[model samples]
Target: MSDQIKFIVDSLNKEPFKKNYNLITFDSLGPMQLLQVLNDVLAEIDPKQDVDIREEMPEQTAKRMLNLLGILKYKPPGNATDMSTFRQGLVIGSKPVIYPVLHWLLQKSNELKKRAYLARFLIKLEVPSEFLQDETVADTNKQDISAMEEEKDQLMKRVERLKKRVETVQNHQRMLKIARQLRVEKEREEFLAQQKQEQKNQVSTESLYSGSQK
Candidate 1:
């Protein structure tokens, strides 16, 4: 026998609850408390076990705990109940290895069942914590919604500013183009006027000379 298994057996022998009941009695126990005890026992049991508990029939551990507590007596505990619906004369391994892990699992299941029962009772009373939780969740959701709206507003403002800036740049460019065109037109007009005045002076000089010749 490994020291770990011996440790579990010894611990349970001394536990206040187990001592209260000669055999295992779970009827008056709270679920959460029972689970804690089960976990404690399992902690002691795992190091001594030879098998990988995760690969084994996990449910059997639960069954064993309940059976040990005298809560589930209708069927025999452990893999025996799991493997055979009706006993066949043929047995696979004449002896099955009972590990501390299996027993620990059983203990945990019993504890969980008790806790579930307590939870149900608390729910029936409509405890304050339940309502408080709903309010907290609602407040959290509201904050998230408000934050999103604020971000959206900021993005919209930024877009509006960018649009205004683009419009101003476009307007300035249009004005500059128009000013250049007007300047070019004024220069062309001045050049044409100068040419016209020069032609008039030459014609006037030619007419005067012709008259003199006559």
Candidate 2:
């Protein structure tokens, strides 16, 4: 990670939260130190997301840390380095791979915390009139709502079109099923008619033979 980002994260931890971190050796941290930092950062973001690395192995701690980060919707920075980079970077001390993730985590910690708070706040509390009282905020919200309505309409139309196609397919299948039933019924009727004709022919042949014999 760049010095600028490290400073930002360090400053953020220092100021309002008064959280202590080994930012100077952030890039060269061992797996255990890294795990402590991770747990602290996650706790700062959300207390419910705290991880215990005390009894677990290094690999378990690394994997569990990655899982927690994943729950917060954090994707690894580079296209080359995927989520699996945790063990190599955190455990094996790969600077290029690990620092970026830590940098991202540090930078996003406050933002995520605020978002979590807002989500809970909105669930229980209605939108405060003070925020809506601002013309800019109200207008922006109105524009957003209008756009969302348009998107919803488009999605509903697509769903209706799909339903129509499905109905057409169902109708075709129904017709084919009826056709098969009719074919089987017609075959059975033809077989019964043929059997009756053969019985009459045998009876006529017997009568003719009896007359000739007499």
TM-score for each predicted model, relative to the true structure = 0.22, 0.43
Number of the top candidate by TM-score? 2
Q: Quick one: RMSD of model 1?
A: 32.6
Candidate 2 lDDT tens digits, 1-62? 46855664575467554655555655455756555766666677777546666776766555
lDDT (Cα, tens digit) per residue for candidate 1, span 15-83: 432534222242234433344455344434332222333344434433333322222122323444442
Worst 10 residues of 2 by lDDT: 121-130
Error of 2 at 100 (Å): 1.6
User: Which parts of model 1 have CA positions greater than 4 angstroms off?
Assistant: 1-170
TM-score of 1: 0.22
Q: What overall lDDT goes with each candidate model?
A: 0.44, 0.60
- Residue pairs with clashing backbones, model 2: none
Error of 2 at 109 (Å): 1.9
